[model samples]
Target: MQWKTDGPRSIPQAFPYQGSKRALVGQILSLFPTEQVPLLVEPFAGSAAISVAARMYGRAQDIQISDVNAPLMDLWRMIIDSPDDLLDSYTKMWHEQQQGENSLVEAKAYFMLKRREFNDTKDPAILLYLLARCVKAAVRYGKNGDFNQSADNRRMGARPANMQERIHGASRLMQGAKVTSGSYEDPLVNAPREAIVYMDPPYQGTTDVPDHRYLTGLRRDVFSETLQRAVDNQVSFIVSYDVVREDNKYGEPLADDLGLLHRNVVVGVSSQATLVGRKEMSIESLYISPALVQRLGGQDKIDDLIDVEPKTQDALF
Candidate 1:
């Protein structure tokens, strides 16, 4: 199951993730170093969606993937180490909840139990199962870092075939990829010479306050130095963060003093837009280091990657 660009749109198959980059992987991959990058790293491996694209497409040789969330990494490690066993266990659990006269009740009960039992069990498969069955495809946590998100409002989960494909695909992506549990800094500091590092950290917030769920908030000012460190050490890094919209909503732009090249990827209004009669808005900026930009084969490729859509400027006014 190779990661493919020639798919339905440019979206490759990915696990159910709330902020899944399935829609954006195509564009991101197109911007990776056009030559052989020794190592490809995703520090914030939420679903490891981008690396899956790299693996599926044969983009790089050595891969290093990690995340701060230990349990989430555990699930991915399980799939990579024992794809068949994890798949079997997940399938059984999925079907079990569909049985009995009170199937919906049974399903809800099952989800809650797994949600509660996750920390204790540290069962990779259970966590993966819940990610599919959980609300909004989200993974939220309490201050103590417990699985605090609720179960889905609906009765049915994803079809058996769908889950199986994603399980297999993720397993394939994880093969030989250095999956680890720790802060993003380790991978950045220890990155292979000329490795291409793609980072999607807990977002910088609009209120300048961290979303309690994504508590591993980064300080833009400090983080800019982090990106610089990666570059100074000869590592190519790309970071995804909030960019001001045409209406100055969604989130504030990365601090202007960083001296990094940013490309705005326009994402239209989501269904959950808050304003009563507001126009659609939300754009993410990718701050790429100069060395990485140079490695991406001059301004032509960079221009394509930054391929900004025709946005109405009036919204900003």
Candidate 2:
């Protein structure tokens, strides 16, 4: 069907992220205001996929991305400010990967070595390589706030040519974006009047998963409070999550006071879930601000706003 980012360098969505909205970039973007969108703010910018795509597709000319994971933010800043240097270091290390006999063991050992390098220097290249080599691109960390994910043998990380192109492609989209390292609340606190804020924070349903393991039980209340302020200021927002509780699944809905608009957004089967059993379907409710809703024609429900079909369930797989 010619979806964007289906292959290497196929779309402006350049970063290879774990749960990227790259494929759903179109669907997510369908909700953008037809009027001028001044800024695109993504607080939990895991891979900055949505932010970059929004800029590339003209949803917004400016972007601001932040994450509590400082090292992750460091990678984006490096890509934005010095793509060539970051790519050079990455290419050098990527070429150093082991080949032939016992390659898996050798490569895993080398990955840990580079991870240590990333920890010591906070080098963007090392982090990029680690993310590509780590299991399912998931970044797990210990209670000590250190990366704890082991290498995955099942995957062959992207080759250097593609990876280099990715860095450059992302750099192009980042030309006018602000990259920061701090809490998601910081971005919300400073959200502009005409900005569109999308929060894809750690999902409450997957606390056991590696990506959410470290961040769970930390920011629920604080996030709710900060969101309230954004609401008070009439800032636009689209939060991905819903209040749900099932057999073994549980999800949290947005704070009631904000009274944001919402619609179901079906996501693909989780890669992490696939490892444990058969693929499991997941769905999120995108809670949009009243201001954004009115901008989209003040409708109670828009066809593009809610996608419940299985067709969209694998957008990121």
- Backbone clash total for model 1 is 2
lDDT (10s digit) by residue, model 2, range 109-165? 788888777667876778888888888676777655567777887654778788887
Error of 2 at 314 (Å): 17
Q: List the residue pairs that clash in candidate 1.
A: 2-56, 3-56
**lDDT value for model 2:** 0.70
Model 1, range 172-193, lDDT digits (tens) per residue?
6658988889888879856876
Per-residue lDDT, model 2, residue 80, is: 89
Off by over 4 Å in 1: 1-4, 7-14, 206-211, 243-246, 267-282, 297-301, 309-311, 314-317
**Relative to the true structure, how large is the alpha-carbon lDDT of every model?**
0.70, 0.70
